[model samples]
Target chain A: MSVDTASAATTRAIVTDAAGSSSRARRGGQRHPATSFAGIALRTPYWVLTAGLALIFLYPLIWTAISSVSPLAGTNQVDGWGFGNYATLANYQAGI
Target chain B: MTATLHPPASSPAPPEARGARRPARRRRGRRTHGALAGWLYAAPTALFVLLLFVLPLLLVLQMSGSDWPLLSGNQGPNFPENYQVAVSNRFFMDSVIFTLKYTVLTTVILLALSLGLAMLVQESSRWKGLLRTSILIPSALGLASASLLFYVIYSPIAGPFADLMASWGFTFLGTPDGALWSTIFLIVWRYAGFYMLLMLVGLQGIPDDVYEAARIDGASRWQTFRDVTLPLLRPTLALTTVLCVTGSLLAFEQFYILTKGGPDNSTITIVQLIYSVAFQGPNDLGVAGALSVIVLLALVVINIAQIRAFGKKAED
Candidate 1:
């Protein structure tokens, strides 16, 4: 375990060494951010775009959650909000 | 992938010591136990590959030649007959064409989109963690589970979007195009973050001095990405490309759960056809094994071509 940790740490040190801290040194040296993706200012548009992408990724699972409980017309749905799908899945193949 | 991330093991001297003269060759020789330790560490993975992959591969080869059935023992050898059957199977051509189309589309879209996402998340901004986390969380879901989840979500009668889809006069999986795009969307949503993480690693592995020089030279962001980032990321691209192509070719769980090769069997991938042949109507393991061997061979060829293409690009 110690050998594994030592090797992993050594590799990380090598990575950090190879990558260098020039960007951090530059950032500390001056305040001259511009339009590069890595060097860009953390403006409102950046946050908005990233958040929007996050929503697109997360919305489907959220919708699945909502529809999982909310009643529907043709599924093995109960009369009201319930775990009908979960129940059906639990009973499938002896619920595995 | 692992090789690119680490300093090449063959380089005995550290980068800084390469130009120094301090008996580096003899005095700085490797410890004797290092090789033994490396082998000891690698033993488990080697054992696993030998057991799981090599053993199954040999079995599949044998099964491909013999008249093996799913439920019973194998009969006598049939040699080339199973290969003929596999090639002439009813859905063989259609499934191959569909799988190829899916592979191309998925590879292009996923690679481009993941590159963009990686670029976005690689920024030293506050939202980086949130975006990366959310995007990658879906990858944690098992592919089968994600397929089932999308299956319910794509259900025409019970889905959340059913009403909107009804109003729009279109269903998610009612047609070939719709089914393809919808499944692609699910796949993109699930895998984009994972691939982005990979690309991000590659991006971060690039030395900051190189980008600093680019910026100092007044190189445009686009120019820097094209000349610096793209070239440096070739190995990662090759790895991801081979992986995406292989996974997309062997795609069965998603279609099996979401579409069930349905709405006219337009989405029946090659692996699904293999499964149906072995377990479904035909119940022929020999043919299935032959198909598997063919797919394996194709994968080896495709991966070699991709890696060689990337290698030539690197040399140039």
Candidate 2:
């Protein structure tokens, strides 16, 4: 039993001990946020540009839905009432 | 050694076999970079589909279900009534018949003529490219623009076609049958090259070695084509047929602007009827919405049936 325990200890040491000391030293000298900031700074322009473009292309459908269902029907009139224009479809069935 | 009897080796394990592991690490790093770049390139297209296509389609579907008017508030919760009216309308029936007829006739004639043209041009070494390009030029013209072009082409007084037919002492677009034929011919002229392009692609994909082998085996030209080329071309043939049928079924602009569904509304398509009923004639938005939904469902069913039929036929 003593031999078995000793061998098990040796195996664990081999598996876990290689990078433990080096990793601790590295962590002491540097921080996680610093590395994360470097990564963010390197990749920010791409992410920001993509997010901006997504908003621009998404505006039309948002506007259409809001107008279609909102009671703010301006000169366009499609927006004057909520769901009225959509309801009129029930009465007009020549093509349906 | 027994499983539990083996002792730990004192020697280092060949420096952890560094040779194979290093290249694997390097490859993993390179793969990560490639994946990031691919995502960066594809992000814009993904955003476009998400924001523009998917969202709008959902919004339209919602709108189609409600009693939403342009200038007034939602009066009541009405569902399925719009679809019911659209399905029951006589005008819908007329348009559906017209559209289906146009699709069937155009798709059949277009496939036959285009294949013949491709065969003719394939045999010709000189002017082949030019002929193909010239034939394809008509398709590049916008459909609305093509409609105007054909309008002038079919004009009774000054049109080249009328003059050509005058020599034969006949009118081109005067009678119902005459107008329909002219429309079909115009569509064929405009689209045959496009189908020819697809057929040519299929034809070119066939290996020269296969043809040579068949010839050396004493197979006749017709036999080689029948047994080899046609089988290889089944996929392209099915694709082009589907495209032609769908486009024909959606026929609107030419019939609407040129004929105005004239000759007693013979050329009037379902879409045109939907447009007239919803906007032009009685402003019956209900019926229009209903009709639109039915047509949309019908289109889906037709596409499914077409693919299944093709698959079954191929299996046979």
Candidate 3:
């Protein structure tokens, strides 16, 4: 049991040393923090523009879902909310 | 030790032959089991299609024969009377002509635009990703939603283009011609990118070696494209054309939202007429069902014709 414990301790030490060296190597090879920050700043405008365009494309469906439930569906007024509009679908002569 | 523990390689009855025979029997059993498993896996999809598509189609056929009303229960079978009434309606015939016209125009424009865009974007370039994404963005919007947005855009009172158009002494949706053109424009803008994506997939399936061989043979760009690309793209083109025609024939939302069959019902689609017949007015569900059956028959005929045409080219 003592021999077994001793060997297990040696194995644990070897693994820790290997992990520490690899981490040090990675840190050494990585770009400077300031350069990485500048890279992100440079890419920001493209992301912002694309995101804005995507929102514009999606706004119509979002608007329709909201308008369907809004109480002022036929009227210009945009106040109050209920399932009143949906009830009209049931009132139609055909079974939708 | 060897004589006691092991068997001799040379025996009167060969072990190798016996071993091969055993494995062959096992393989035959495995093949039979594999076929059964395959059928078991396919059974669910077959059942689903039967229940949903075939059953509903049979029901619709039965409904078309009977005097089915919207609110009341089904009456006794009226046979061909409902079909005769549907066929005799002048408005229904006019809607059919209008739907055919729209289908032709939309399919032609969509094919041309999508093919053009696909060619432009086929090459690997810097802006290809952005161009593809930006173009496809409009297709993500539902047809109804896009029509509503265009409704606002075409409104004379509150439209952003109202002032510009007024300055030019023009109206976007004032007349039947104007409304039809506007709706067509909206549809083209919405679907061109989707069709372009389909065409792009077809284009990418082509190997680079084919183009290289064409170049080595000293064929001009236009000649090479005409001879090779068009022939190869036939299958994809057939698929897109069928989809475009079917969807255009069933068009309802754009006209309903943008024009509301306006300027004297000139923009009324066949589907809109069916909707009015079944849901509005006297609510004759029987006639509506007959009309739907007629439309389904037309679609099946068109699709079969398209498939045959494409198949002939493939054989060639």
Candidate 4:
């Protein structure tokens, strides 16, 4: 009986603490309302510029990787999907 | 016995003591934070070098021992076969000799040109800044782009460079002997500015007072330059020469784009030959990896020898 009562009392205290903490958080957020929008409103342009430049610089490397594995490397075939192109390197030492 | 910690109330720790403790505690907090920040700042660079540079190098060294291609998954152990194959190859021998010859020639030319440019620009003239800027512009061009530029410049049918050479009763880059000189000229023009900057830094470090005293003592321009300038510039000269030699030894892009190892393969560098063996002709990356290891070992030995030679000069 004592154990049951103690457990119920502990649960009540936890609920009360959580409710109080959340109320405090909401009040704090309301106090400095501009802080909430500061990140998105101030930093959006920089984020966009960085993303654009990253894409521009990375395009060539992406193209090279795609070209290295492209199926159009062979005589007639336009599309290749498997590792056949990589296998052709085995016939590399046929001559000097 | 269960011990519970508690502060004594009889003679309380002083308020100033508590205040002092706050700063100590703050210092402890800052030390941990600062150490963490240092690690955080260095982590990206460390991880990048570890992953991209170090790992690939180790992988290449491992690949050099085995007869493995780019796609080799699992192969029987024929350890050291690649090394043997590369060692026995006559082309590898020729490429090494060619590379050494080119390195020596290019280093000599680059050092001379850079030193001359440095001397010219070191004068306290009004056009010094303009001259420096003009000289350095060539260095800003990418090696591959510069090679393409030279390819047109060296072409006989379409180049005024060829006409200018012919007017002087000589060809520049049309033949093998001419092509070697032409390539060296291109390299000297490209790198002279960068080395000039290094030389300029060394020249600036010489005290104005020393030059004043030398002038006051009626020292001639030649004597002042020969005695004071050269001795002080020894370290810089040695460093620049090594850089020029190493960079020239690793020559690839300029030759590949300009000469394509032409005129009976007289201009073929070690790296160009390695590229031909690995990718262009045979696609034998195993032999290429072995050759890379050999080249790396050779560079290490050369660097050590160079340091020993110039280090003695510095001591003197």
- For every model in order, the fraction of real contacts preserved is 0.40, 0.00, 0.09, 0.00
Q: DockQ of each candidate's interface versus the true one? A: 0.18, 0.01, 0.05, 0.01
The digit string of per-residue lDDT tens for model 4 on B1-316 reads 9997676865668999889889999999999999999999999999999999999898778768767665663254456898898888777777788889889889988898788778766754444555666667778878887777677666665443557767777656557777788888778767778999999999989876566566556689899899889988988998997898889889999889888887778788889978987888767788888889889899989989998988998897
lDDT of each model, Cα atoms only?
0.85, 0.70, 0.80, 0.75
What RMSD does each model have against the real structure? 15.4, 27.0, 16.0, 25.2
Better of 2 and 4 by TM-score: 4
Off by over 4 Å in 2: A1-96, B1-42, B69-76, B161-171, B312-316
Chain B TM-score in each of the candidates: 0.85, 0.80, 0.87, 0.84
Quote the positional error of residue B105 for candidate 2 in Å: 0.3
Q: Which is better, 1 or 3, measured by DockQ?
A: 1
Taking all chains together, each candidate's TM-score versus the true structure is: 0.76, 0.63, 0.70, 0.66
lDDT tens readout by residue for model 2, B1-316: 6575445574445766767778999999999999999999999999999999888766556655767554463455477766776667777777788788888889899998787667655644334455665567666767777666667657776454557777777775666667677788778766777898898888878776566556545678699889878887888888988888878877888777568787777787888888887778756655566666677788889889888888887998
Per-residue lDDT of candidate 3, residues B1-316 (tens digit): 3566446654445778888878899999999999999999999998999999999998788878999999996998999988998888778888999889989999999898889878765655445566666668789889988898888767676555669888887888788889888889889878978999999999988765566556556678798889889888898999999999999999999998888787788988899888888898659999888888998999999989989998998899
Clash pairs, candidate 3, are: none
Candidate 4 residue B113 C-alpha distance from true site, Å: 1.3
> Higher-lDDT candidate among 1 and 3?
1
Candidate 4 Cα errors over 4 Å, as ranges: A1-96, B1-32, B71-77, B127-130, B161-171
Residue B287, model 2: lDDT of 59
The lDDT of model 4 is 0.75
